[model samples]
Target: MSPLHRLGLATARHPWRTVVAWLFALVALGGLASVGGGEFQDNWNVPDTRAQAGVEELRDHLPDAGGSSAQVVLHDDHRLEAAVVHEVVADLRSTDHVTTVTPRLSEDGDTALLYVRYDVPTTDPAIYEDISGLEHATDAAADAGYEVEYGGELPGTATSLQGRGELIGILVALVLLVIAFGAVLAAGLPIATAVGGLAAGSSGIALLAGIMDVSTSAPTIATMVGLGVGIDYALLILTRHVERLRAGDAPVDAAARATATAGRAVLGAGVTVLVSLMGLRLAGLPTYDAFGFATAIAVVCVMAAALTLVPALCALAGRRLLPRKERRAPEVSRLGAGAPRSSTTGIVETREVKEPLTARWATTVAKRPVAWALLALTILLALGAPALGMRTWPQDGGSDPKDSTTRAAYDLVADEFGPGANGPITLVADLDTVDRAEVKQVHADVAGLPGIAESGPVTYSPDGKLAVWDVEPTTSPIDERTTDLLASLRSDVLPEGVDATGYTPLLSDISDLLGQRLWLVVGFVVVLSVVLLALMFRSVVVPIKAALMNLLSIAAAYGVVTLVFQHGYGASLLGIDHAVPVSSWVPILMFAVLFGLSMDYEVFLLSAVHDDWLDTGDAQGSVVRGLSRTGRVISVAAAIMVAVFLGFASEPAVVVKMLGVGLAAAVALDATVVRMVLVPATMTLLGKWNWYWPFSSVVEVRGAPAPSLETSDDERDDLEEVAR
Candidate 1:
């Protein structure tokens, strides 16, 4: 047994006091709960060299200009009567921080928009206050004896998911968890553990963000993950404990064995998961670095809960946790021919391996490596077939949320006056004491370009030192055609002194950046994961083997995502409204998550190998036996994560949905096919290769081999050895 396992078992000495203390402290943590929102910006890293700069210039010219950009559309219902408009405008402008309201015109004359302007940036408290203003505007219109409705970015995103968002989701999840577990107490325990873990996790995220402005999308992500995974891990330990009590053991012994065994899984899984997330830091994007580090920190808290509070609490509950029927269950059968009496509700005795009824899933591949490899390649190719059909790459700002008003207005304008009307190409040319006529010639050159649809009146800056024009293109903003037009504006039309920039220009720049830098990120991930694995295993070959497994898992996930989201296969069943362009960030995010998740399974399955090899010195046999034994636990864990991801995917927003579905697909594949079948078979084929590397495999076990399925005596001493 690993020293950690022995150490955890030792925690069962006084479980009840630990339980009481945990419950009391958890209750205290609840009262201190406060809601904190994120940086809440659409584009975090865009530079001011393009049309973005021009937009800022326009905002700067306006009086007391607030940096808020929102779309307020009045539907073409009879609600747009003068009284309704008057009431809306009155309420909106009368709001404490609101400065202006600009109404947009519909093609028809009846509908009018009241653009509710704010004097504060999106990150300010006033952004939320404006949502209240929206509510007031709606009420004011009704009070003035007119009907009105309001929907926009501010309400859909800002207000709807603000305070107690995680708490609300937890409450709903609690109801589900209680029903699934068949005990209120059982369900409550996981929630308590998760809340404690999240409190610590969020603070960790704040620390990371302070170091570098990590992607603002991280908090929501951390909350969802920390809660879900923390709760699930706690449930796994609790379930094992209940099973132990059902058998014939006392509370302390039952808790001891439960912590010794399941604790191994939870701690190993958590560490693996944490390491995998760190893979994103390899990608070099500051955005992903925040995501990786935040997830890792949260996962660490989860590991702490697993190893400390949970085991202690289980010990405290004693026989009360396990009913009389469950108390009769035990680990092994006396006859060695029949199952034990522990048909406990949570624990069922079952055969580890089902005889091959049709195909030996792992063995078949193990016996015929080339044939299985070819078959795997063929399946990957078939799934990737839909990549050919993924059109609609990106429009307007690539970062534009599908429901953004500017993009929505651009879409409507495109449908009517042509896509060109939506995005106007910007011409930025420097001015000096020289040649005013040269600037005019530059404007004329761009104006006469074939794809120019609508040209704005030439406007110079306040000092007459700069000139600019808004040139509508023949395509929607950021489309391939517009990109081509942008190229023309820069290369063919611009005079020697003129510069052209727009949404397309920024997209172009980012594309170049991604192309130049993405491989460096990939290399970092590979090197880091390998080095970490070698350090953990004391076998260089182990890291190489792990990298291959992680790649396969990631590729399979990409294939699944491509097939589902890109090809529109079973998308409706998946609740996806549109098979839109997957975000450019998806690949980076997937590598980070997949690598981290693969580490989780690796730690889990490899821990068994580590233990068995120590006990039996049969590497291949150890893999088979360890895989057979750990299969159910990892599968159950993976299933829960998949369900969590799928549930989140049901949201309306495409990006958020993409994240969920992508992780769901990845986990689903990882559990069944990758972990169960491919991993065992491939490792079986490459016997010694699984442990080959530049460094020698430790002939003697290291002092500590991470938290895995087994324990070491020396490692136990380091963990505060106690006589239980």
Candidate 2:
């Protein structure tokens, strides 16, 4: 027996031991997390950018102004009390990590802005806790009849892994499982296995955070992926095991066979996911790297559970995994009335059940492959058209929920001061490399620029080797005009050795970097996936085709995101009232994720097809039989993923919602149009060439009878003609 088969058999033989071991591991990890876990902090370390260089200079030369900062927005609807404002500023200045506090009133004098600077970067773990002092100081202003809100890093840094969305997704998944499996206990097994995996994986992330700069958003992203894949993997294995039992095999033998078959596909699918995610490292951003690392850990743990825990659970469930009516009936081989049984596990007996609806559909497509293939291609292309116009920017507090303090603060700042007041640019000059007089001249000249709404006086660093000037533009941070202004400043305006930094400039730089490297990341991920799929399936054409199909799915998803978010087509339904640029890194992240996920369905379907091809030696017949066997299961898995992702689409954060919606759309399309319609049609067109690979071992089975399908005489003739 193969290693996977042996492992499955061993676990099935001692089901309780496996269960107990998994439980102990989960509890131990949970305890470790509770005692020693470290807080997650985002590290957006883009070293090559000018904005990053400016930030580094600030940190080195001016520690007080170098650290993260926040804006305290105060409004009174009438003239504000000077004493209360000063009192609040005094408390903030004494707060821990507070280095500088500058207060400025609006032109109308009804609003005031407190610019508070800290002594640490926004990614520092201590900053989140220390910011509470600033928040507490604001309470004094609130008590004095002034409305207070926070902008910048203050409100955007908070993170949470718990929410109603996760619960709702799991509940929806359970309902779908029951409908698909027709047995509550069987449906519950996947849920149990997935939860076990999710718990262990989350604890692992907590442990990882203790050592590295894991982002606060990592856990939520990891959970979303792990939970969906975990359940789908288990469902694939359980479905095969139950099919084996109904074929009259002993439970242990059934579980072993299922693992040997479906387990291999699951392993391959998990590897593809990991490979695609790890490709994020090529983006050369630490934040993206951490994202890949955290999500990969989740996938690894869940995949392990699916491969091991699932078999044990299946053994425990036994006949209960089948429906009540089916379990009560006598065991019989679906192959035929007198099919021989083998002692060794293998595909010696092929199932000959009546024609399933999927089989009929596949046959119909096979008879008219060109028409069906063209239809699928057209739909995919049409859906993907909008991606050509996608505009990307890093998400900011401007996209926060309207009720949030951050959004209120952002709006207030934009309204009272010009919109440019919300995001200012800091110019830093390195005196060691540039003339100090020239720096002052450039600073003075910038104020007269067309986009400049206002400019602050130049302030020299304590060392006199560094000078800083803050400038505000006339447009909002996300505006195309603002992006053009930044580009102009960097390429044509700023003198040598002088660089710009600030939240807005930093976002623009990050967006530019991601845009420049987007194609490289896509190429890396696609090439790697194609190579891996080629090795796993041992067919060049299959892997290449799979890659193309996956790209189509991802593009379609991107188009949908562009339509919904950038065009404001249906943004209000998702709680976003205005059009926002697609989050800069979201597409790369989505491409990497979708490529791997789309492969899951491909692997499952192809595994079954390859098995039938080896047995019957008929390419067309194998496609029909494979689709018939695995179609319902693939649909269920896709539906579960869509439901889980849609739950996250309801998130308060725009980036999370974009990810959720994009993933859901891709999975739904891959499972239905690509896998169901296009795959069958395209494979029929390829015929025997589908398995052509000179480097791989080739098997020949001559004059072998194909599996039976229940169809009318006319339909049978058409299928036979297509097979010929």
Candidate 3:
């Protein structure tokens, strides 16, 4: 058989391939899950500060941080009397991990706070299990005639990570997949694959973290990306394969042909996505490097599953998969061509694409590039306008709302007490020495800083050599006023002290660090994409255009995301209840993931156009027809991604929300607007000029195509018809 027929037969035998792949993945998944952290978080969200200088500093100064920590809170105040606190503290000290505990007077004096410190490190693997025993410790309080009420970080962090993160995410993810894929089983399969695939990937990350800077966020990202791309891509291929089968071929033949064509598309798209994500390595931030590596791992595994495992499963469970197909027929267009369309509710059955932009849409867009391009550019810019005004930096969620307060507290304090009440500005001073007078001078200077509404006393490092202070700025963390004040201190204030002594300054060095890395990160993102695309297209111009397109997409999506999340505009309607920061890590991550996904579409759509141009030499016809043929699946894949990723927008955390929303928007726009129109139209304007530089030698290309473009209209027609 020819390569075409061979691919068809392989797809028809997809069941076996799937079984083999699953068997392979399952072993890795099992090993991965065996060592999951019960409740440790990497705390990447929390930037390192002079830990001894902040609340810890205050607590240290207060004479005791060793307070009795509470695990569960009770609404009844009378139950948490002094008797209850004393008894709980007494009982907790008996536990091995509980080094000491002290009871405290609550803000009201009617209620009280208990501070607890562990003899063991919080990073210990058994911390959750040990901390979970707190309820029993509280039970001891009840015996002493007090209803023990409790609350703190140990409970919240442990419970959120161990109990809620995956459970809630899994449930939500499944519902999202069903909604996105329009088939329950179809959606479920990808989720299952991801569980296994991501599990293995997370294990690698954790293992890597043991030596590198990989943190708890790495796993969250690993899992999320694994599930998002894995399911999204698998569902795309599956849906396409089923559609091809419904178009007339047998299950076997359909699987094979779809495997060859759509599989190739899926594989090529996966490669592009992987390439895009891998580009983040260029950013030079070790965290981003780890993220880039982990993300690349997931993309690779997801592609493997989508092509090999999914295909094999199709072969094995060819007909039984429609477990609900009999009932679903009326509502879904299954793989069986003769199947009848049913109700409109289930699976969102439809012959046409969802919310149809209208079939006439293409013709209209084709007719008026200037109008649509202007309109799109206008909308994107308008969406991004809020971003130009955006401000953000790293923040630590650890102290915000503290340990005792639940979700009930953040807004209450931030609103009535001012946003500054939530987080304090930490000042780490590497003075010439820890001389009492020098320390006192820096203290007075920082305290006098404009935004310093309040300041706690400074504390010396272990050797009494370095002092650190905590300042509660009147301004919010991300406010221009605060950053301005910080800059002023760094530029004007720090130099005076530093000049007094020949010692290097913290602010000075850090400033230089950020300045150097900024351009490096930008250059990394741009250069890698250019190199990858150039190699793929063998045209420097193509790579440049692809990079430009990706930049436009990222900028546009970020603009809209900032508008929705940061400006609190339409957030409520989207189920976002309050304003939020655009995750600081989002820019680079979007660069990697979106760049990959956008380029995925780029390869899928453009390759066909390029193939046409190569074979028959009609760039215009090839562009139009290529887009037309690939348009449907590209739209479907993008739509599926939109649903999966946008589902994550419901997450309260900005990072998860950003990843989902940013990615969804980028994929959707790139497919519909960029790939379909801008690319085609731009190429149209360029005509044969697109292929010209093949003769020039500005950029590198080795053994690249020396396409003989000379051809007739008849030849172009034949190639175009065949390619379709």
Best by lDDT: 2
Residue-by-residue lDDT tens digits, candidate 2, 161-253 = 337568878899999989887999988998888888988999999988888888878888888888889999999999899878877778888
Query: Candidate 1 vs candidate 2: which has greater lDDT?
Result: 2
lDDT of 1: 0.59
Best TM-score goes to which candidate?
2
Task: Give the TM-score of each candidate.
Answer: 0.76, 0.94, 0.73
Give me candidate 1's TM-score against the actual structure.
0.76
Instruction: Tell me the spans in candidate 3 whose CA falls farther than 4 Å from its real position.
Output: 1-14, 32-214, 235-254, 282-286, 316-360, 395-421, 425-434, 458-463, 467-469, 476-480, 494-519, 574-577, 691-724
Across residues 243-262, which tens digit of lDDT does each residue of candidate 1 receive? 65544455666666766766
What does the lDDT read for residue 240 in candidate 3? 52
lDDT of 3 by residue, 1-724 (tens): 4464475476456566556656776676556545642332342211232222233332343322312233333223443556666666676767656655645353454433444556433434556324546767777555655444433445434423322344555676567656644567666776676665665665555555555555446666666566666765666556555654445445676556555655666666676666666656655445666676667776777776676666555555454444355434542334434644321111223466453342245445656657766666666566656667654444223222233243333333344345554445555554453456766777787778777777777766564434555566686554557556656665687533222100012222222343345455656656876776666656656668777777787778888777776787776765555676565567667666777778777877776566556544555655665666567657756665676666666554546666777777887888777877677666666655565556553322122222234545565456445533
lDDT of each prediction vs. the true structure? 0.59, 0.86, 0.56
Candidates sorted by TM-score, descending order? 2, 1, 3
Flag regions of model 1 displaced more than 4 Å. Answer: 1-10, 20-43, 47-68, 74-125, 128-192, 203-216, 235-272, 275-290, 317-377, 384-425, 432-436, 495-517, 573-577, 697-724
Candidate 3 at 6: error in angstroms? 6.0
